[model samples]
Target chain A: MIDNTMNPFLIFISACLINNILLIKFLGLCSFFGLSSSIKNSVGMSLAVIFVTIMATVVSWIIFHLVLVPLNLVFLRTATFILTIATLVQIEEMFIKKYLPPLYKAMGIYLPLITTNCAILAVAFLNIDYNLNLLNSIAHGFGVGVGYTLAIILFAGLRERLMTAPIPKALQGYPVAFFLASLMSLAFLGFKGLFGL
Target chain B: MSKSNKPGISAPGTAAFLYGVLKGNPVLVLMIGLCPVLAVSTSIFNAVGMSIAVAFVLIGSNVIISLVRKRTPGEIRIPVFIIIISTFVTIVDYVIRAYSPELYRQLGVFIPLIVVNCIVIGRGEAFAYKNTVKLSFLDGIGTSIGFFIVLFVIGLLRQLFGKGELLGKVIFSKPALIMILPPGGFITIGVLMGILTYYNLKKSKV
Candidate 1:
């Protein structure tokens, strides 16, 4: 397993490009498709995801290693991790509403969806699955978020252009968007084995 | 589109089941659980396995949530629903792992992801919470059948074209390898959705 000895820098890059959470791992496709209809919303969603993934991954790591593993409660991971994420998202929402009113108004709408954005939960599980240490897990989380932002933003840009392009009536909305995703997935596959991670 | 969101008359079991199959087909219409649809539909075996697992979880969660709907406080209802759904998911996950280890291995992360499938929780919040236990049970089976129909078709096509096999039996001499890859999943679902949308539009026009 590349978990223990993999360098942090390499982990960051690999997670971003080589193993993108959306195109490759398919962790968070819901928002990738749902929010990518517009660049602004996609970027906003990505920012929210970046914040939540880092926090959720780190916290889940602590809970899994310090609490679950020690107490032989590993089976509770699926339940516990999701509960932790739900709570974290709730807290983040409350905090934003309390102090960062402007940010709340801008990105608050996407925060509630984060609780169900499999990417955050997926990252939490991946951290444990990969057996990454605390630092590595955080790096991986950040990498997944950055990769998601990069992919969604790029997609949003393409979609903005697609709006003007002539499309068949049947393929107007999601069908065309899905075809675009396939092309993107095909391109992303090129990054496979790039760093051999 | 309006029909998809309108609550089904859960009292009539067949009506509830048909509602799921045609109007609220989870994949083509509501698009609730596309992750599993796209990820596990590469083969018939995997597709059926996933659908059954989802059916088990959905039925179990729906029945349980309905039975306790009155007691499940609104403030913590979502969390309560998540825990209940995850419990069923965990059970299915272990059962699959124990008996059909191969299918479980093939499914990988998706089995666990079932805990978070929007359709299960979506139905719970939308229908089960407001309906009776018997109706919720039928609704679960209805939606599962609908989901199964989509999964089965996609799996059959993907396996037939992508691997030149159906349920592990050879169908074609040469298969289109791309049909089974991630992109293939997207393209298939996209085209299928397009066809379904076009048909529905034509049907509604007359």
Candidate 2:
């Protein structure tokens, strides 16, 4: 078990780099691959993931401690957390669409996708699993979002270049993308011993 | 390719079953539900456990959704499917915890994450909702088999190369430790996918 008493900054750094939710933990590959075809979509999706992951972490943390624990309903964690995330994504989508039209337009399509991103829900589960307090949970959540953004944006840049590269027809799309991700993940592996954590 | 069989119409059971196992493989083809595939496939045992758990949830949810499709409202079908899927996942979670503590530890959060696995929800939304319960059940089986096949092969490769062992039987003194790590998972899948694509392309040309 990870030490829950570790510094929040360390937690943030560890989450962002060492145990990156996407590259290391493999939490959110669907969107990682699906939305990474273009930088525009990657940025848009990253913003939405950042927003939803942090929000869902906060909400799930509160619900798990306050509602589920008190009611002795910890077994409902899976269902409740998913439902909470789905609902949060829905409400956030509507709120953005209604009041923040420009931002909504930027991330509208990605919002619905965030509901099933798994990273959001995984963050929620990690917060509880690691027994992190609210502050640490927030930090971890933000760190994961940042890590995802870093990986996807970099990958989008590579994929844009890949579009024009002469490649075999069979290995044109996803196969090549997976190879790219493999190299990126290999690079991220170098960050493992950072700070000796 | 039968002319009389239209695209909108669901395929027959045997075809549906074969489709997931071959043509429409969830991992290799549709490319959904990849998280668990790369994560728990470090060892053959973990892979088998995960496959069974996923099969349970996928089959349970697909069968239930097919049974309740007519009564379920279209606007809310997704949520209902999620609820049903989560219910099954929770059951699998507890069952594993009670039965095999080691696997329970290894799988950890991934067991719960099955609720959001695109393959489960994707199958629920795409196939089970429109098809009969029998077909959905077959699809669930076929898809799980597809998942199992890929996962087991990856696990076999990783275990053999990573630890110089298969099913805990050591075959060599030195192993490429990277084969069991995060990057190894990515690279293995990438190469396998590339090879499969190459084979398919070559066959088509022939």
Candidate 3:
């Protein structure tokens, strides 16, 4: 049952909206809390992450299957995957700078900030760490990254709006954001049934 | 190396270690790493196991990151950092699985999720990368203790009110189911954060 079409699609939607890596899984809380202050940066950071994640997933899959597995070096899976991601992020930064300098400036510190984002590293590890083939991994990368984007965008949209919303004095910043996350996680609890797939 | 103060101990090393456990306060001051704190604190046993596992990653990764911090070019530091952090995570995962499958199952996906816990990488980047090994080790202990303190409190509350017991002892038969569920975690952490903020504010005013 190596079905990629429907399963991948479901996985994407579910990961994005339901089992959101941020709200539920709590994968990349650092970036979620740190970079999500402004909607503009959130959008840029989200897209850059989505872009690099697809690339990292593809490359890491290849390395895991072709190099690590063959050499009895599976023990080094996490190390290799992370280093490769770091290297790929470097490549991405340079490529963006040379090719998309304008867009690069728009992304700003988030470009480098993505390096520490555990979500990015988590995706890389999941691609091979969970033993998905190239296609499955790609679907996962797309799914999880979109899932990340959706949550961040949604949160950013709300938080951006909240900038004007009358939040209580104590609950203004992280407090309110956390409360929202808690509620969102509760809302996401509705999606556990989709796992019937 | 850690035991004998003269072997590799230094002053700043002492500071970072203690800071992580208490002052920097991964659970309170840093106010990050709350995911595991909430999710895994449903039981006292889980809090204990997770804390130990986190301590191992903090110590090993902190030391390794500090050792390589200088050579890691600024442009590529982040990636290099991930590689290092993920490596230690994998090693811990394997060691844990081999020796302790029960704890592994209880931790569930969180053991792997440690790859992303900012406290581990945060300590690496913030303290370990610049300090000595001994100090990094202490930082690991301190941070773990802080995490342990937070998790223990949450676990105690959840196990008490949610399960009618502290560690399955059945202190009271009628427990609140909501307290053990996910929302309960948020509520508890929220109140805890408020109290911490209140204390911090009061202390500052003094």
Candidate 4:
């Protein structure tokens, strides 16, 4: 499954740019707008997304392949994915609180928010809907999360420095953010169509 | 959790409707659910279909959520919204698949993804719970229409220049590839937002 497939570099580029979950696909948007004000929080939020997405993908993959597929319960994908993600977030929250309290604090409210992050569930659905195997799913999840982190970090860095940048009267906070997202997405569009990896 | 800044609140209903259209703009101003917008807004027909589907679910969920608002616990309000939106989105998804397979193909996975759009949940939390059912319903339609109008405009303009046609025809010989790319979507929407804001500022001035 790993050796025989689409270009890994294309997967990375697609997740990061052409199929960007934020600017294009509109997944993980809550975190994009909420936690992007500071680089520290952006990193924390991105890390949290990475954790929830990877875990949720693995668990959901196991469930879908082991149980749902056999039962032909494909219609239940939405309900199942949502429940699995909520449960995953709860478990991760408890473990982090106990084993990594400082990191938990850094993530704080954003941790719980990951449960509602449609990106996690959306990626799982994409895996099944596209019928990718376990290895591909993991690679896809990792790539998307990294894509997410790249976007958040890029956005956070820009937004933080914007603290000193002058702006027009009405086009201050959100307008600037949206414009910046546009530019960043434009930059990412450059990565299209280079995948012989 | 709701920051109810209901100003002197005379006919807050109308104000809320207006807010969704411009002040709290879903696409341009708020920048929510842009994924489907940019992806589907290549043609007028696709945008119209997506808009109608979104409108149906948004209005349906808003009314349902408002009806259940009194019984819903605060701790679980969000989950409930999620479920309601998901259910409606699923229904739309299946119905679209069963009936309009062609449009379904065009919209692709985005139809099902309507569940995750922040605009729906945001509408539920911000307007549906606080207002009467009637107000909530109106607000939903108004906001959805506003969203639809914007998507339609963007789609129409893009198709016109990008493809040299309005819907799918090729009204002109030379089409602009820039209008079909990611950067094109951003530039068009950015300029549209600027113009809209300028008009908004002018109107508010009067």
On the 0 to 100 scale, the lDDT of residue B176 in model 1 is 94
Candidate 4 wrong stretches, greater than 4 Å: A1-4, A7-14, A17-20, A23-26, B1-19, B200-206
| TM-score of chain A, predicted model 1, versus the true chain A, to 2 decimals | 0.96
lDDT of each: 0.87, 0.89, 0.74, 0.77
Return the clash pairs for model 2, or none.
Answer: none
B1-206: candidate 3 lDDT, tens digit per residue: 00111112344655655666555778667766766787788888888989888888887888787777778777776666677777778878888899999888878667767766767877776667667666777777888888888999888888888899764466988888877776677767777777776666678889
Ordered by lDDT, highest first, the candidates read: 2, 1, 4, 3
Interface RMSD of each: 2.2, 3.9, 5.6, 3.3
Q: Tens-digit lDDT track for model 1 on B69-159?
A: 9998899899999999999988998899899999988898788888778889888988899898888888899999999999999998898
Q: How good is chain A of candidate 4, measured by TM-score?
A: 0.91
DockQ of each: 0.58, 0.61, 0.31, 0.38
DockQ of model 2, rounded to 2 decimals:
0.61
> Candidate 1: which stretches are off by over 4 Å?
B1-4, B8-11
Binned by DockQ into CAPRI classes (incorrect, acceptable, medium, high), candidate 4 is acceptable
Give the range of the ten consecutive residues with the poorest summed lDDT in model 1 chain B.
Answer: B1-10
- Candidate 1 per-residue lDDT, tens place, A1-197, comes to 33858988888988899888888677788778888989999978988999999999889999999999999989888899889999999999999999999988788989988887877887887788788999999989999999999999999999999999999888888889999988998899888777776
Give each model's clash number. 0, 0, 7, 1
lDDT agreement of model 2 with the native: 0.89
Cα error of candidate 1 at position A98, Å: 0.9
A82-169 in candidate 2: lDDT tens per residue? 9999999999988999999999988888988888888888889989989999999999999999999999999999999999999988
Per-residue lDDT tens digits of candidate 2, residues B1-206?
A: 00111124378888888877888788888888899999998999999999999999999999999999999999999799989999999999999999999999988899999999998998898889999999999999998999999999999998888889875678977999988988888888988898998998899899
Which candidate has the top score in DockQ? 2
